[model samples]
Target chain A: MEYLLHIAILVSIYAMLGLSLDLIVGYAGLLSITHAAFYGIGAYGTALLMINQGFGFFTAMLLGMVISGVVALVIGAVLSRFRGDYYALGSFGFNVIIFSILLNWQSLTRGPLGIPGIHRPELFGISFSDNVMFLILCIILGAIVYGVCWYLTRSSFGRVLTAIREDENMVQVFGYATPYFKLVVFVIAAMLAALAGALLASYITFIDPSSFSLNESIFILAIIILGGLASHEGALAGAFFLIVLPEALRFLGFPSDVAAQMRQVTYGAILVLFMLYRPQGFLGKFRMN
Target chain B: MDILVQILLNAVIAGAIYTLIALGFTLMYSTAKFFDLGYGALIAVGGYATYWSYKQIDLPVWLAIGIGVATAGLLAFLVERFIYRKLRERKASGTILLIASLGVLTIIQAVIAIIFSSQFQTLSKNIGSTRTFNIAGGVITDVQALIFISGLVIMTGVGIVLSRTLFGKAVRAVADDSTVASIVGINSPRILGIVAAVGGAIGGLSGIAVGFDTGIEPLMGMSLLLKGVIAAIIGGIGSIYGAVLGAFLLALIENLGAWQFAGEWKDAIAFAVLIAFLLFRPKGILSK
Candidate 1:
């Protein structure tokens, strides 16, 4: 039961990440691979505030979101100038830069030693120290993000994002500043990613640079691709499936050494197979070109 | 003055390795028009093949090198034939290809790790046995000199192949416009296959050289690939000579920058240079 609950908590956190990324990659048609950087920013932000400043989880989370947003604003502005593959490359560079800072900024980040003993959230006299309580908090936050994403995608602004994704020039020709739209969605996605990061930090009670590397970003990307691009249900389903699939594989009884490597191989095979045959994904509204 | 010479020599050796990788990378990018992340895996494939043959099977060094290069080339050909070709036929976009390449890279790296136990392996029989030569004020080991010589030889060979041969003409025609080239009966797919094979061979050779220099690790491919990509992009993507130039320039900058700071800063400096180039001159130094 406890193990199941732990998986549930992780699924909720990843669901948030998948949903946030869906906004940028699915709706806005921008492939920003630096989503993990924002997630890390939030995780580190919340961890640092709680440990150093003695702040509550809610406050630290909010602050983390703001910090991620500010950084996204700067990066998004520069990145919005690029289109298609260049956009992916630019974001890829940003992720590397952020990761390097996280690893190298030893004075502040404590480097590879990682920030340990991160405190659990205490909100409105309710301590979320228990696993069950933390799981509830994560679900609530995930739902909130999902709701925001659902509403945003259905709005007129959401139409413009899809328009930009399909044809940026057409959107610009119709009098919308496409870059501004891209920047707005990018910032929103960063904040939501940060929220998920905050939850992860609190739950794990530890954070490290390894968790936010380029591979992590690619793993999150795999989640969205496997789930379905541009579909909210797809994001949820993808997160649940990817998270649960690995756990299910664990029960297959392969040697421990080979199992982990096999899991990665499976993931790679699935990604390649999907991209080749089912570019539209299981529940996706749009097909990745 | 001695330190300066040492740094310069180190920079040149680094530049040679980068040139080989970047040349292959640029060749593929020009033809395929996508970032082939799978190329990273081929680097590891080359090194591991050499190690398996030389260490495990006890093959001669030359035979091991030939087997390693052949393995990489054949794997690249198979990938292009089976995976990338099918995708290209479907008119898959660059982004899709990139993602597919990432998947291929992941699969290959994982397979390598599973087989090799993720432990760093050395190809050199004895590091201390290598003879060191003093060129001007800088010292270079035999392996480093071999790498430098190979880099120059491969660059000249590729340059001649691309410029003076009918095959090169076909490759250039395909790169300029695959559709038009195919319409004119150049057989673009065939040219692309040959390019992938050639690129993979060079990439494999680079992997072996790097293994001899430091060691081979499953995860080292990504960093090496990134440096090569950076060189290709900075020198101008799709331009062979430009990539070679960029490789040397990048090597010089990274080495000089590392001289002033901690060694860990080397990668950061390389990336910073890449970002700067991307921001200021996206076309790179020599625009094709």
Candidate 2:
């Protein structure tokens, strides 16, 4: 039961990641792979603030969102200048840069040593210290993230983002400032990613730079790609599938040494197969062009 | 003066490695018109293949190198014939191809790790017995000097072929416009397959050299790929000469930055240069 609860928490955290990345990649048509950096920023921001400033969980989360948003604004500005393949490359570069900072800035982050004993959230004197309680908190937060994405996709702003994805020049010709729309969605997505990061930091009770490297970013990307682009339900399904599939493999009695590589092989094969046969993904309305 | 010469020498050595990588990368990119991230994995393929042949099978070094390079080239050719050719037939976009290539990279790297157990391995029989050459108060190992000479030779050979040979012209035609090249009776797909094989061979050579110089690890391809990509972009993506120039410039900047700051800052500095180039000069230094 405890193991099940741990998996649930992880699923929820990754579900949030998939939903947020979908907004940028699926809706906005920007193949941005920098989600993990924002996720890291949120984790590091909340962790540092809570541990050093004695801020409450909610307060730290809010500040982390702000920090992520500001950083996203700067990054989005630069990323806006690029389209398609360069956009992906530029975003990839940012992910590496942020990861380098996280790994090297040993003073604040403790670098490889990582930050430990992160506090769980407290609301109105109710502590989410236990696994079940933390699961509840995660579900609630995950639902909020899902709700936000749903609302955005239904709005006119969301339509513009979709339009930009389909045809940015056509949308611009229709009097929409495409760059601003892209920037706005990118920022929003970064903040949402940050929220997931905060929850992860609190839930894991430890945070490290290694957790947010380019590989993590790629994993988040694979989640969305597997789920279905531009489909919120797809993101959730993807999160569940990717997170659970590896765990299921663990029960197959493979040697521990080859288990991790086997998991990677599975993911790599899936990505290739999907691109070849099912680029639209399981639930995605938008096919990755 | 000695320190300066040492830094310069280090830059040249690094430049040689980056040049080989960029050359292969640019050659493929010019034809495929997508970042074949799987090309990066071929580096490790070469290194590990060579290691297996030399250490495990106890083959001669020359034979091992031949097998290593051939394996990478043959693998790349097969990948083109089987996967990328199909994707191109479907008219998949560059982004899709890039992601598909990423998948290939992941699979290849993971497979290598699983087979090799992810432990760092050295190709050289006697690691400490390497002869060192002192040039202008700077030291370079025999392998590093070989790396430089090989890079130069490959660069010259490739430059001559592209400029002087009919096959090179066909590749240039395909790069400029694949439809037109096909219409003009050139076999674009065949050209692309050959290019992939040649590029993979060059990448394999660099990997084997790196294995000899430092060591071989499964994950070593990624950073090298990034540096090569940066070099290609900095020099002008499709221009062969530009890749050489960009590689040297990148190596110089990286070494100088490492000299001024901590060695750990090398990647950051290299990436900073990449970002700067991407922002200010997207077409690169050579493109008009």
Candidate 3:
């Protein structure tokens, strides 16, 4: 039961990531590989605040969102100038830069040693210290993220985003500032990814640079890809499936040493197979042109 | 003065490797119109193939290197034929191709890790006894000299071929406009396949150079590929000359930045240069 709870919590955390990434990559038509950079920003920001400044979880998380939003605005402005492969490459550069900061800025992030003993969120007479309580908090936060995404995708803004995805020139001809739209969606997605990072930091009670590398960004991307791009529910389902996959592999009785590599191979195969076979994914409405 | 010379020499050596990588990368991008991240994987495949033949199978060093480069070229040719060709036939978006390449990268890196156990091993066994030469108070190893010579030779050879040969003209046509090239009787698909093979071979050579200079590991390609990509961007994405120029400039800046700050910040410096180029000069220094 406890094991199941742990996995559920992980799924919820990653689901937030999947949903957030879906907004930019799916709805906004921007293929970003820098989600983990924002995720790392949130994790590090929140961790430092809690560990050093003695700020509560909520305060740190909100501040983390603001910081990520500001950074995203800058990065998004630059990335908006690029299209297709350049956009992805530019975003990838950001992820690597941020990761380098996390790994090298020893005075701030403690470098590779990582921050430990992070306290879970505590509310009005409600401590989320217990696993079950934490699970509830994760679900509630996950649902709110889902709801926000749902509203955005269904709104006029979302329609514009989708239109921009399909044909940015046409959307611009229709008199919408496509760059602003792209920038705004990119910022929102970064903030949500930060939220997930904050939740993860508080829940795991530890955070490190290794957890937020380019590989993590790719993993987040794999989640949305597997879940089906542009679909919030697909993100959720994808997160659930991926988070549980390692455990499923564990049960298969493979050598522990090779299990991780096998998982990577599976992810790689998924990306290739999906692109070749099901570009729209299971529940995605959008397909790459 | 001596320290400065050594740093300059180091930058040049590093530039040699980046030149190879960036050259191959730009070549493929010119033809394929997408970032084939799988090209990064071919680096490791080359190094490991050489390692397996030289160490495991006890082949001669030259034979091993040949096998390594050939293996990478074959694998790249196959990938182009089996995977990228299908996508191109369907007119898949560059974004989709990029994601698929990411998948290819992940799969190759993992497979290498699973097979090689992610250990850092050197290609050259005679590390201590290897011959070295001093130029202007800076030292150069035999392998490093070879890397530099190979880069220059390959660059000149590729330039000549592209400018002088019929096949190169076909490649240039395909790069300029595959649709028009196809209409003009140029087999764009075959040209792309050849480009992939050639690019993969160059990338393999760089990996082998690195393996000899430092060591080999599965994850080594990512950082190297990033630097190559940055160099390619700096020089002008589709221009071979620009790729070479960019590689040397990038290496110099990286070494200088490392000298100014710390060695670990080398990757950050390269990326900062990339972001700057993307913003100020997205088309790069030389665009043909």
Candidate 4:
């Protein structure tokens, strides 16, 4: 039961990540691979505030989201000039830069030793120290994030984002100010990613730079691709499937030493196969260009 | 003055490594027009192939180098023939190709880790036995000199091939316009295959040099590839001379920055320079 609840909490956190990424990659058609950076920012923000400043989880999380959003605003503005492959590369560069900061800024980050003893959130005189209580908190937060994503994608702004993805020049010709749409969506996605990060930090009670490396970013990308692009349901499905698939692989009983490498190999093979055979994905409404 | 000379020598050696990588990367990108992330995997393939040949199979160092280079080229050729060629036939978008390459990269890197155990492997048998030359106030190892020489030779060789040979002409034609090249009786696929093989060979050689310089690890490929890609972009993607120029410029800036601050800031400095160029001068120094 504990194991099951643990997986549930993780799935909820990653679902938020997937949904946030879907807004940028799916709705806005911007292949931003820096989601992990924002996720790390949120996690570190919450962890530092709670551990150092004695702030509550809710306050830290809100501040984390704001911090991520503000950084995303600056990054998004700079990234607005790039298109297609350049945009991906630019985002890739930013992820690397952020990771370097996380790793090298030892004065703040403690540099790879990682921050530990992160507290579970306490809300309204109630402690979420128990796994079940924490799971509930995660579910509520996950649902809020999902609802926001769903509502955003269903709005007129969402239509403009989709149009920009399909044809940015056409969207601009239609007077939508495509860069503004892209920037707004990018910032929102980053904030949601931060929220997920905060949940993860609290649940794990530890945070590290390794968790937000480029590999993690790519793993999140794989989730969106496998789940189906531009569909909220696809993001949810993708999160559940990816989170469960690895656990299912664990039961296959490969040698402990080789099992982890085998999982990675499987992930790589699956990604290549998906791109080759089903670029549109299982539940995606749109195919990545 | 001694510190300055040392820094300059370091910069040149670093530039040579980056030039080798960027040259191959630029070659592949010019023809394929996609970020082939799998190219990063080939760096590890080269390093590990040499390790296996030298240590496991007990081959001579020269023979190991030969096998390593061949393995990288062969693997690259196979990937182009099997995966990328099929996608090209389908006219898949560049983004799809990039993602597919990323997948291929992941698979190769994981397989490598599974086989090699993710531990760092040194190429040189005796690190202290290698001879070093003192130039003015700076010291240069034999391997570093070899890298510089090899970088110059390969650049000149590629320059000649691209400008003076029929194969080079065919490659340039395909890169400029594959459809038109095919219409004019050039086998674009075959040209692209040759280009891939050549690029892989160059990348493989650089990998081996890097291994001898600072040892090899399974995850080293990504960092090398990023630096190469940045250099290629900054030098102007398709221009061969531009890539070389970019490599040196990047090395100079990186080494100089390292001199001023902590060494860990090197990667950050590189990326900062890359971002600055991307935002301010997307066409790079030598736009094609």
Candidate 5:
């Protein structure tokens, strides 16, 4: 039961990332692979504040969001002019470059040794020392994020993003600056991803460059892809399902050595199969193709 | 002058390996309209296959390289037909395809690590380990010469196949529009199978050659892939000749950067170039 809740917490964290990514990749039709960089920013933000400046969790979390937003804004401004694969590569460069910083900037990040011993969030004479308690906090954050996404996706502004996805040239002709809409969506998504990162850092109580590599970004986006791209609920469901599936694969009595490899191969095959057979996801409103 | 010649030779060898990676990368992107980020893993796969064949079975040099290339081809065929081809049938988005490639990459790299222990392994045969000749006051290894010759052969062969053959036209047809190509009776699935297998084979050869030129490890593919991507981007994403030109340019700049600054600053320089290119010319040198 405890493990289940822990998985639920992970699902929420990834859902946080997946939903934000869906906004840019699904709604805005702008594929950015640098979401993990923003996620790293949040983790680093919280970690640096608590460790270095002796800041509290809530204040650090807020600052994490702000710092992530500003970074995303700068990257987005530059990359928004590009489209599709170009945009993806540009964002990818940002992700790799940031990862290099995390790996090589030994003084600040402690390099490959990683940042350990991050204290749990404390507030109002209470400490979030238990996994269950942390789970509760993450769920609440997840709900708030869901609410914001729900509002944005249903708003007129949200409709503009969807339209931009379908045909940005038309959106441009309609007098809505396409790049401007993309920038707005991208920034919001980056902020949400950073929030997830903060919650994740607090949960793990350890942070490393390994967690923010292109691999993690791809995994988060996989959750969105598997869950369906456009809807918040779909993203959530995808995260929960994929996370649980690997665990499910664990119980099948497979050998330990091959199990890990098979899990990934199976995971890749499943993703490809889903993309090939169910382009719309389980509950997506529109087909990905 | 000797130092300049040595650097130039090193750049060419590095450029040759980068070109192979870039070629494989460009082939998939141009045809599939997706980034198979997993191609890097295939490089690792090739290197390891060659390693095992040479180290464990004690296979001869030529046979070991052949086995490695064949293994890559097999892996590619199985993956595409079972994985990516299915995704195409469903008309999956580029992002979905991209994510799937990541899963493959993670799986493949992990498998290599599990088998090889993530340690850098030297090739059993040192084709150019000791053989060297001087050219205009600069020393050049036979392996460096081999890399140049093989790279030119592959590039020219690929160019000719793409431009002058019926098979090439079929590939172009399918690449342009699979549905329309199928309507023209091009058997796109078959063509896709061939190209994907070809890409894998090239990647594997690339891996072995690179392993001989440098060394082999599990994680090397990521940085190499990044360089290949940089080459593809600066040269234009989908063009073959563009990829060739881009590879040389990237290696030249990177070597120059490493020479000018510290080796640590070399990666940073390449990244800066990519950023500048993205900012000024999103379409790249070849501009689709």
Candidate 6:
């Protein structure tokens, strides 16, 4: 049961990641690989504050989100000038550059040794020690995240994002200021990613560069794609499906090494196949309208 | 002066590998107008293939290299014919295509890890035992010289093929406009497959060089591909000889940066150059 709770917490984290990505990718039509970079920044930000400055949970999270948001703001400012593949490349370059910093900045990031002993969340004189308690806390956060997604996608701002996705030049011609809208969506999405990262680090009590590699970024993108692009339900569904589906594969009697490879292959194959066969995704609308 | 000469020589060899990979990128970008992130994985395929062919089967080392390049090219061709072709047939968006390449990269890397266990391997068993020559106060290892010569010869050959051959004319025509080329019955799909195969082979050679030049790992492709893309971009993406020049310049800059600072700053220097280019001259140095 505790094992299941652990998986649930992870699923909740991924749900947040997927939802965050859907805003930028699905709604805003930006394909960025830097979401993981923001996530890493958030994780490391919280770790540093707590470990170095002795910050509590709420304060650290707020600071971490701000840090990630600021970084995203700068990155989004320069990169939003590009569209489509250029944006992806720019974001990818940014991700790698951030990754390089995290790897080589031994003095600050501790390099590959990683930070350990991060404590769980403490609120109102109560600490989240039990797996069930943590899961509840995470689920609440996830729900709040979903509500935000719901509200944003339902607003005129979200309509701007959708129009930008379909045709940025057209939106600009209408004096919609597409870049500003894109920057806003990007930073908001980045904060959500960081929020998930902070929760994940607190829950696991450890943080490493490995957790925020390009592969992790792709996996989050895959969750959004697999669940259905631009659909709130798909984000949650993808989180649940990909997280639990692999565990089911564990029972299929495959060798451990092969099983690992299969998981990687499945993630790729599912995304590619689904995109080709059904670009709208499992639960996505045929049209954004 | 001796340190300068040696560093220059080392940079030249590094530039050779970068040029090879960047050529692959430049060709695809020019012809297809999309980035094939999977090219890096193809390079890994070539490196591993060369290792397996020579080390396991006891094939001649050079012949093994040929097989590795051909196999990688063939793999790229198949992917173009199958997945990429299908996607292109559907008139899929560029975003979708890019994501698909990432998928290919993921699956191929997994296959490699499953087979090789993520262990770092070197293609050259006698790299350390190779002969060295000192000329004019600069010492050049046999492998280093080999890399430099092979890079030049292959680059020249590519230049000839692009100018003299009818196939080259078709490739250039397709690059200009795929629709017009297809109207002329140029077999766009087949041409794309062949072009992608050639790119993959070049990419494979680049990987093999690095595997022998340094060491090989499944994840090395990520960084190597970045350097290659940077070179292509710096040289004005899609230019034939521009990528070569860009590679040398990037290598020289990185080596000089390392010499001035520490080795860890090499990547930062490379990316800093990229950012500078993106900010100042988004079109690149060789932007034609």
Q: Report the TM-score measured on chain A for model 4.
A: 0.97
Q: Output the lDDT of residue A284, model 2.
A: 86
Superposed on all Cα atoms, the candidates' RMSDs to the truth, in angstroms, are 2.0, 1.8, 1.9, 1.5, 3.2, 1.9
lDDT of 4 by residue, A132-244 (tens): 99999999999999899989999998989999999999888878778888899999999999999999999999999988977778778888899899988888888888888
Which lDDT tens digits does candidate 1 get at residues B199-272?
99899899999999999988677778888999999999999999999999999999999899866678778878
True contacts kept of each: 0.55, 0.60, 0.77, 0.69, 0.36, 0.51
Off by over 4 Å in 4: none
Off by over 4 Å in 1: none
lDDT of 5 by residue, B174-283 (tens): 88998899998999899988898888888888888888877899866777788888888889888899899989998899888878765655666777788788778756
iRMS for all predictions?
Answer: 1.7, 1.4, 1.2, 1.3, 2.9, 2.6
Candidate 4 chain B lDDT trough over 10 residues, lowest sum = B217-226
Q: Using lDDT as the measure, which candidate wins? A: 2
Single-chain TM-score of chain A, each candidate: 0.97, 0.98, 0.97, 0.97, 0.94, 0.95
Q: Lowest-scoring 10 consecutive residues by lDDT in candidate 3 chain B?
A: B87-96
Candidate 1 at B196: error in angstroms?
1.1
Better of 1 and 2 by lDDT: 2
Best by DockQ: 3
- For the predicted complex of model 3, DockQ is 0.73
Q: How far in Å is the alpha carbon of A54 misplaced in model 1?
A: 3.7
- List pairs with backbone clashes in candidate 4: none
* DockQ-based CAPRI category assigned to the predicted complex of candidate 3: medium
Candidate 4 docking band: medium
Query: In order, what DockQ does each candidate have?
Result: 0.59, 0.65, 0.73, 0.72, 0.42, 0.56
lDDT of each: 0.91, 0.92, 0.91, 0.89, 0.82, 0.87
| Per-residue lDDT of model 3, residues A1-289, tens digit only | 9999999999999999999999999988888988999999999999899889999999999999899999999888989878788889988778878988898989899998999999999999899999999999999999999999999999999999999988999988989989999999999999999999999999889999978877788888888888888998899988988889877788898788789888888888888888998898888878766
Fraction of true A-B contacts recovered by candidate 2: 0.60
The C-alpha stretches of model 5 lying farther than 4 A from their native spots are A1-5, A250-263, B1-7, B87-100, B110-120, B124-142, B163-166, B169-188, B260-262, B265-268
> In model 3, which regions exceed 4 Å deviation?
none
lDDT of 6 by residue, A163-279 (tens): 898888899999988889999999999999999989988999998887887778878888888888889999899989888988776799878877877788888888678757887
